[model samples]
Target: MSIIVQEQTGLFHLQSSGMSYIFQIVEGYPVHVYWGNRLKHREPMSDLLIHTPKKAGLDRLPQEYPQYGSGDFRNPAYQAELEDGTRITELKYAGYRIIKGKPSLTGFPAVYVEDEAEADTLELELVDAYSGLQVVLSYSIFSDRNAIVRSARLVNEGDKKLRLRRALSASVDFQGTRDFEITYLTGAWAREGNITRKPLHQGETRFDSKRGMSGHQFNPFAALVTPQTTEYQGDAYGFSLVYSGGFEASAEVDSFGSTRFNIGVNSFDFAWLLTPGESFQTPETVMVYSGQGLGELSRTYHRLYRTRLCRGKYRDQERPILVNNWEATYFNFNADKLVSIAEEGAKLGIELFVLDDGWFGKRDSDNSSLGDWVEDRRKLPGGLADVAGRINRLGLKFGLWVEPEMISPDSELYRKHPDWCLHVPGRRRSEARWQLVLDYTRQEVRDYIYDSLSAIFSSVPVSYVKWDMNRCLTEIGSAELPPERQSETAHRYVLGVYELLERITTAFPDILFESCCSGGGRFDPGMLYYMPQTWTSDNTDAVERLKIQYGTSLVYPASAIGAHVSAVPNHQVGRMTPLEFRGDVAMSGNFGYELDLTKFTEEEKEIVKRQVAAYKEIRGLVQKGDLYRLKSPFEGNESAWMFVSENKEEALVYHFQVMAVPHPPQRYLRLAGLHPELEYEVQSGDSEDKPIIGGDRLMHLGLPLAYEQKDYESGWFRIRAVNPGKA
Candidate 1:
């Protein structure tokens, strides 16, 4: 534990169980009936109060309630009820210490605040890990009800330098119910309208909520489906409003399971490597409510998710199992090679064939050919339409990949109009993964992307698009705009992308889009507002994937995680895990494969057949069921994960040993969110038990954790077919 409070400022502290990071609220500015259980201070800490504009006088600030109609607290705050109950007061006291801030030794200083109108907006300046490394994040805050207001920017005054080797994050907490249900998801990096293809409106960049959700993603970010609640129990619910983003994320609820949150993160954007000077950030929020289902949360978020379309009509829920060719083919191609794989894929019940990153242009690899959206006839003699036809004939939906915002220097588009890239025309530009970022803030560029994609979808029975944004913005200078408008590009770029997605999804309701940034570089709530699912990771090995997927599931639903079985000697980690084990592990979420099945041996094919069979059996349970995280995957001992039936009729449990030992005795494990009085028959299958399972038996008897020597590697876990709600 560490507590380092600035003199006369709010108390500062941080601690962890070593497995997960934990934070406690100490003394701070008192709000309307400021409500947090006082934590025991183990060490001597000074009690100090620091207020801004001190001479303004702290009196008349209202102790029993908030200064109604006073001002905005967009930085983030916890709320205490109002005096008359007409409204609630939320306050975000200033903190002197920064978790990760500006002039960072390596990157830039960063902070996020809701625009006065309350849309997630960020302000920062970062160093480029890659050359031409300059970044600008600025936006005017006003308009939307959920927007951020004028935020105090963290700056690099030249004298200060900071470096963050690992992911540096800033979290904004919401003041909500201790007893409430919260929902979160990550996807969407697109939208519709001209939003900002011109004189960067730093002031008008917020959505007009009165318009009933216009120009945002498929869903909006941080929604409160139900009204706030002020109840929590045990040692839980401290930060009733807190959110973080890194390689992965998670949340903790009390034993009731009553305070449920079906947090769904767009599975793609699995991981990112930000070296010394790069900066990364996410728009995180806390949705507070007391009781209800996931639908309620969706309803609230959708209400605020500014868009020109209606999600109610497009509620075509359920993400399809996708087979991405990138992991299999790796840019080297031939239509024949893909067709062969699609044939096997159809047989295994794969629903979509996503041709990732290389089906177009002179793009033989990731190095070149990004901006040229035209089909590269050299790779596929017959063209994209022909490839789509072949895949459709194989009884599967065809999906194409496009990094629409990037242009390769070697490509036709880039060569023809070099000035089209994000640069000052005379100045140099930055490049990552062998491609330059297209200026999305430009109207013509955005139009080209929208038109090209709509044309492509029109040419074939394309059901999905794997929209990829491989890197963050850098060396920010756009020659197409005036100097004053140049800094507005970053914010405008986002709005432009959202504008494109809104139009596409509205036009093609049947077509689904998956957002990906590198392997999992840009996993944020902003993205989830558009796409329903995302590629969880580039790492497909089962053993290593368990942790990656586990951490992902903390705030995201299983349905959003795009997991697949690929050839062993996992490309990323190089661990040669068994094919069955890989398939079985992936079965826990959106199931698919990343390897070339056509090249697989006969035995491997048979294993896939069985794997498909297993997936079909557990699909419903995994998609809609209640999830539980048993042991720490980060910890070497026994690790466990399970999915309980949506209706509580069945339960599927899967356990793996990170580090196994011989002669281990039967260990007892306590199941979470289970009822004791309900007698449950533990006869294999994911189910809801009807009979009295008994609290004593459940709590006292405990679950059998120690498996037989052979059962350990064999991956032993019971699939209890339950009859919940019965006698």
Candidate 2:
């Protein structure tokens, strides 16, 4: 049984395929005790729960969902103001149940189970009797993985209204104050998702996104680890919020010397006013504990999110290799130019041709015609259908780019209804990229966007859509909503985005959707839940992508990263890298091209052909296989990564040297995820004949790599099992 309840001890032990989470009810209050490697047997909790020098009302005790009114002094996961206007909360376990399958989150995107046999969820109902606020804490254990998903649902069963100031999704309490460190992702627009690690001090270490959108400043992820944790050993706990709005996650050491971690919606400018019978469901939080190190921790997240969190027809399918015309011609292409580029692309084996930004209504530049979905006949003399049909005739699929979340003041739609934009009267509207945000909270606005998309899809033969949001929210006010509900604008806007995505994606299941926000500004689990992949970053330079891709792999999978080889002097970074290195780096993700094929030399054209063929051959393995981070770019001048097939039959390794070093020694890469007893054959571009080696020696002793002493150099290798053995 995945979930076991001990009635006598009031202990609930939830076990996934490889880990366990145990919590027990003490004096009608659920207290968190252990979460780590699975325990083979249950032990007595009398000694575990005993705390000397107790504070008032057990507030010092470690709890699953700590409350304010209780004796615990640390930050409470649940907090609210009662009728008397005092913020105090005290909840006791009221009831519980082991359900057959995982429940879904209403009005938000979350992981789902297709069958009851896939997972089992344990729901514990807790209630604060004085305020009549009921919180249902849920823990879902996967039938075949070592990860557990957690979320909370708050119900206002009281007669009077309650204003919730803080309601986090999950909190974990660790018994020891062992030396620990926190690892998270942080960077700017073009340079995003760089991994940073620092010692976890006694106070609080927090990471959040309050920029209305999940801005490029921080990804919605955090990790707590002991000092001894490494790539393959020690303990590492990862926390990722399946949300894209403003959120907060922190790890704190309280006065009692216990480490507490919490993650949920940002309470900093957040207040939910709940009336009678209204329930609020927090977004899901996925927690994974890896005793084997940070690499295993990442693989766990990658596997879980790839299978359960992401849903669509393309979720498990191999994505096509497309050429985007954004950097090729920017916003100055006509239908004839697009068709000519598509013709050249088809000749080079590209599968799709994407018509980016400028194809829409008078959008020759970023300044005007947003929120106007009509095709600009000036740019595309032939309408969208004619261009799409021409591209189809060239033996390639057609894709269109759209920025449905922003509207320009110069647009026809904005002139018709200026109130449709998110603005408050008497306040100057702020614009980013020369565009203001559409008030998504308004049903009419959402309907208009949806209908516009539907009409386009129905008129054209588009097989893909690059959904973009170029700006963050500012001047946060909605003309349609009253002043009392002004604080709800951020959360409501995200929900409205989800509604539009759900409606359109569901209506066109076959269309491959890719999320973008001026590169990867809005990349998060919430977006991946709707779209299978996201543009990794606007910095397409191969040298820069090494760090970006490496940092992103700490949480996201290869299938969720969109990488492309662009022309050098790269558009964003202006770095001139070799075409081969560019292709090598892009092959680590959903491979594509962002360069002009019409301008390529004959030699460069041949290289593109070979790259297309190579990527198509191994894309299945890279997309679905187990990924291993060989070396981090953050730690050194080189970056290396590998992907191993699930059956341990094949492996692909990528090695990159960011800068050339004087008198550098040969590098040895230790392979992962191979059967130690089996024999494997290895091959590379420089090797004359395939060499066979024992997987045990290859992993323990490592394999030596030979490369040129040049900046921005790369090497690729493939290994196949020669003898079958259990992994």
Candidate 3:
């Protein structure tokens, strides 16, 4: 059993592969005592609780989920309003059980397990005796990974409807720290996932996304670490919300110096109605602890999410090399032009051809024809079937892009059913990208979207879909919901979107789905539960991508990052770089192309073919290997990263120099995760006479590199283990 409960002391200790979490009942409330490295034996700490006589029964003790207006006043983990309009909630422990398998969220996406041998779960029940509100907290511990998934389900057992003002998914209380820091991801669109770390103060520090969709400004992840913690040293704790909706993650330090970490659906402009006999489940929060520092914490998250969170055919499979038409032709292509591009891509060994936006309705520009799903005769006179068939005949799979969450006011659908959009009765409907958001909370609206896309997939032999949402929410109102329930609009919108994706993805399990929202605006774990990958960003410049990709690797795996090589004088940054540098950076992710190949010169075409062939050879290592950040772009002008296979048989290293200086010093990069006893042979793009070095020397002594190139230059190398018996 992963969980052990002491009958005498009312204590429970949950253990994962290398971590342990402990909690106990003090009086009637569950209080968190310890969470860190796993103990070798079951020894209860009698001195875990600190007795405070100054504020008796106040906010001294660390609680699993603190309640407001109940004497113990700090930030609350659960808050609600009764029918009588009171916001007080006094919840006491009711019961608990240790089970074998994990439970699923009712209307939300969560990590799951197939068999009882894979994991064990503990369910703790708490009830507010006055209001008849019951909250069931679940904790699942994987048998082989250092992770625990936590979530809560609220059941209304009273006759009156209960309005949820705040419902956080998970919270953890840590003992007082000497010095603490919080690390989170923050950036704007086209430059997402820049890691920022700061000292944790006495008050509250928060990272929130309230734009209906998980906005580009903040990702739903947070980490707590001591000031001495580094990438490969000290202790670190990571917390990630498995949700793509608006969310809030906060770290609060109390007067006594202890810290509380919380994450869930953003309570700002958010509410849920729980009538009698109804229940609402929050999304899961995955927590991982690493005694070996931030790098191991990231590797744990990467391994668990890559195998358990993401699903379907493309989850563990190598993604096909695709060529997108957005950067190439935009909205200026016809059927013949698309076919011509597909032919050129096929000759260069690209496996899939994606026809980005403008193939549906009259979408000649971003201003019009969004919700109309019909094929436009002006652009593709032969319709989708004809175009897909032509692409298929070229020995390439067909992919189409659609922004289904937004509707143009000028489109036919909006003209017929204007109430289908999210608008108040009198206020003007705010628009982004010249379009209004659809009121997905309406079942009718969800049905319309699902049926429309289903029909298209059935008509055309489409093997892939680039599901996109172009803008964030504006004018937060729902026409179908009541005035009191207006605050439920944004959260319910996300639930509806997840439902639609679940239905479509489950129905077409073989098709590859990639999520996009104005270029990574909604990149979170929840989307990866449905789609295998997400477009990293709109910026394809190699130097910029180095920072973006490095920051993203703190939580996400390389397989989930959609990267592509674009035309020179890059569309986003307008800086020309070497083709090799672009290819090296792009190969660090799910490799593909976003440029026009037909216009490439003979030499450039040869380079493209070489890059495609090279990526194919090491794609498995790049996608599924353990990532080690040798040199951070944020810390220096040079960025160096390495990927080593789990078996330690193969490795790939990427090194980049952002700027060149006269008479530069020689640099040596020490590799990671290699077996010290094994010998390996290194190779670099058909270069011969490479030395055979021992893994210990490579890791401890380091590999030397020449840094004499100009600005924005990069290089890659591959190493294969030499079997002792053969040598």
Candidate 4:
């Protein structure tokens, strides 16, 4: 059993192979006991929870779910306002139940168990005797992964309506600990997921997103590691929120040197009203502990998320190498032009041809035709089905791009229903990218969009859909919601989007869905639940992607990142990189091309053909193998990483240099995730020498890189174990 209860001592311990999370009910208050490397069951576990002096009060003790107005000055996990306008409430431990499997968060995205025996869940019930507000904190310990999935459910048991002012998912108190540094991902627009680390201070340090979606500003992930922690050494704790909307992750050090960590939905401009018998379920937060180091912590997340969080047939399958026409023709391409590009793509071994925006209503550019899903006869004289047929005839699958969440003023849908967008009647309706956010909070609006999209999806032989949301929310007031319930609009809108996705993805299970928000803006686990991959960024520059993809790997699996090769004098940044370097960078993730293939020179076309063929040879290993980041792009001019197969039979190592230096020091790239005793053969494109070496020697001594004289140079090595069984 992964979870153990010491009823006589009022203690509950959730244990995994490498980690343990323990808590105790002390005089009706749940108190955090220990969370770190696993301890023996026979050890003196009760002594771990020391009782503080009465003079110190509740603030001094490590609380499991601290509440405000209870002497705890730190931020509370939840806050509620009563019918009598009072805010103070005390919750006592009521009871708990151990379940066989993890329960899904109603109307939310979470990590799930396919089989009942995969995990054990402990539901700790707490209740406020005065108001009948019941809070159930759920903790699920996975049998295989070193993670604890946590969430909260607030039930309004009383007859009176309970207004929840702030509801966060989970909070943990690191007792007697302050020697920690926080690491998080932060960036904007074209540059998303830049890794940043700083020491934890006395006050609160928070990273959040308030732009409606989990914006490009900061990812809903944070880690606490000692100053001595490195990639492969020391202790680390990771927290990730499984939500797509606004979120907050914070770490605060108290006066006594204890640190409190919390993560969940951002309570900004948010409130939930729970009527009698109604419940509000917060999104789940995944907690990972690694005594070995950050590398192990990240690998645990990668394995769990790749296998459990991401579902459907494509979860374990290789992603197709696609060519999206967005950067190729923009909105200016006609049917013949698109067919020519797809025809070229087919010659280059590209598997999918995606017709981007402007195939819809009067959408010449980003200015119009957002919500209107109908085909634009001007660009495609013969509807989408005809274009799809043309691409299908070229031995390639067909894909379409649609921004179903935005409404353009010039579109027929908006003109017919002006009130369909999220806006205050008297206030100015803010338009971004010349479009307004659709009022997804309204069922009728969602139904209409679903009907419009389903009609087209069913008509065409579409194999994939790039679901893009170009803009964030503004004037967020919903016309369908009352003034008192206006604050609920953002969360409700997220739920509404999830509802629509559930319908579409469930209906067309064969069609691959890739989520995009003007690029990587909405790249989050919540979105990953529905869409297997995300367009990593609009900036397809190889040099820039070195950092973007490197930082994204901190939390997201490489299979979920949609990286592509674009034209030189890159669209986002005017930095010209070698075609080979661009292809090498894009091949690290879900491989694809975003440029017009028909215009490539014969030499360039040949390079692309080789790139496509190389990707096909390694796609399976790259998509499902374990990733080992050898060097960080943010730390130097060079970047390197490796992907090792699960069975330790094959591996791919990628290295990139942004610029060359004269008389540079000789560097060796040490590899990881290989069988230490096995012998392997290493081969690279630039060299014919297939050196056979022991894996232990490769990891300890490493492979040497030959100095190159050019800028934007890159290389990849394919490694295969020799005689695996004999070894």
1-727: candidate 3 lDDT, tens digit per residue: 8988875677888887788888888777888878889865455555554344665674777888888896866778889899999998888989999889887787788888878878899999999989999999999998888899999999998889899999999988886764679999999998998999999989899989878877789999989988999988888999999998899999998887888899999988778899999888889999999988889989998888888889988888988899999999998999998898899999889999999999988888888887789899888888999999999999999999998999999899988998988888888988888999998899999899888899999889999899999888888888888888899888888899999999999989989999999888988999999998999888899889998899999999999999999998999989898898899999999999998878889898899899989888888988899998889999998898889999888899999998986787777888888888889998765578578989899999888887655887788879899874442
Candidate 4 local Cα displacement, residue 354, angstroms: 0.5
Query: Could you give candidate 1's per-residue lDDT for residues 479-506 as a string of tens digits?
Result: 6766534544554455566667767777
What's the TM-score of every candidate structure? Answer: 0.63, 0.98, 0.98, 0.99
Worst 10 residues of 3 by lDDT: 43-52
TM-score top scorer: 4
Runs off by more than 4 Å, candidate 4: none
Q: Each prediction's Cα lDDT score? A: 0.49, 0.88, 0.88, 0.90
List the pairs of residues colliding in candidate 4. Answer: none
Comparing 1 with 4 on TM-score, the higher-scoring candidate is 4
162 in model 1: Cα distance from truth in Å?
Answer: 30
Backbone Cα, N, C clashes tallied per candidate: 74, 2, 0, 0
Q: Could you tell me the lDDT of residue 322 within candidate 1?
A: 66
Residue range with the least summed lDDT across 10 consecutive positions in model 1: 191-200
**What's model 2's TM-score?**
0.98
Please give, for residues 601-633, the per-residue lDDT of candidate 2 as tens digits.
Answer: 999999999889988899999998999998888
